[model samples]
Target: MSNINLKTPVDPKDAYVLVVEDNVSNFVLIARLLAFMGVQKCEWKTTGWGVVDFANTMSRVDLILMDLRLPHEDGYEALKQIRTDPHLQNTLVVVVTAHGSSAEMHKAREAGFDGFLSKPLDADRFPEQIKQILNGEPVWDLGI
Candidate 1:
């Protein structure tokens, strides 16, 4: 993992971020990135069903970085269910996927994603991107 500095660091230890991804390598990379950002309360779920189940047990979550494709249910359904749930509604959920075309972004937006970040994330800018999203700025970095 690479050490990327945050220009305006937000104590990541104070936040709870849930990562929903099926790919182990992707999860590892994201987990490492979150760790490097100083995030201590990070959780992982391998499937969409797992995330929903995990969220039911979690009292608070600051953000959710979810993959569009998964083993069982897709990210879209998971996100929709999460958003509708009174317990998890206000939590920030962003789609982190390889499909970053204009149409895909539009679809994600329509699906009520707080943000959308392209896959093979830019390690150099990831910290800032996450910070921006946490700060109420919608990140749409297509990695273009």
Candidate 2:
């Protein structure tokens, strides 16, 4: 297990992240994990609605950690919106969900999510996953 420091320095502010999760506790946990992984700038949205719009407005959002379930549009819908947009199509999205099942994983893959993380997110693995994504590696671990 790696020890994460919540105050590491990131290269650029524009390398921000968007965390779309309705649960406050999950949000906090993810936010802290991001901070520890050297991602200092992040935007939090409780609902999946308007996520595409928010992401579009940003100059550079390196990544998005989206929850599968939300009050409004679900992460699948949100991911579709993001992927459909020409401007935001290249953005990386990682699905974070408590419902970690083969079916959900398949759906996320079909929805074009860059990665998937099962909650409760392991603090050690969380940072490593983020690092892998940032390094231009395929975020999904579809173990054969």
Candidate 3:
């Protein structure tokens, strides 16, 4: 994991964020924003199939930004697996996707996402939102 020194509203330097996104551009954008938010350790995975293995390798993870639509396994299925895993059951898993319809959000909630942040996240407020979620607050900003 690489370290960054960007100023943010909150100190998320200790936070470890894993972004499960198949799209390279989207992942880059999210990683850049997280770095800008002072998040020191940010990892990426292109498919949902690797999520469990990745989680198994990590001792602890602060958050997971899961894209609802993935190549092999969908985000919902991945979330179910993650929730069932003893090691990662309590980890924060937020749905980060472009599908921000109310119905989609509801389904994501029912599928057990800790929070929901729509795509094209507001750069100015992303850090604050993440900070709140890290502090045990449920954030549901669909941005619709």
Model 2 CA deviation exceeding 4 Å by range: 1-14, 141-144
Every model's TM-score: 0.90, 0.85, 0.89
Among all windows of 10 consecutive residues in model 2, the one with the lowest summed lDDT is 1-10
The residue-by-residue lDDT of candidate 2 on 27-136, one tens digit each, is: 99998888876788888999889998888777767778899999889998898888787877777788888888888887787767878888878887888878777655
Q: For candidate 1, lDDT tens digit of each residue in 35-82?
A: 898888888998897576698787677889999988888899898788
Pairs with backbone N, CA or C atoms under 3 Å apart (clashes), candidate 2: none
Candidate 1's displacement at residue 46, Å, is 0.8
lDDT of 1 at 40: 84
lDDT of each: 0.82, 0.77, 0.82
Off by over 4 Å in 1: 1-10
Cα lDDT for residue 74, model 2?
93
Error in Å for residue 47 of model 2: 0.9
Q: What is the lDDT of residue 28 in candidate 1?
A: 91
Candidate 1 backbone collisions, by pair: none
Q: Write the per-residue lDDT of candidate 3 for residues 18-104, one digit (tens) a residue.
A: 899999999998898889878988889898997989977876677899998999998998988888888787788899999898899
Alpha-carbon deviation at 69 in model 2, angstroms? 0.5
Give per-candidate clash totals. 0, 0, 0
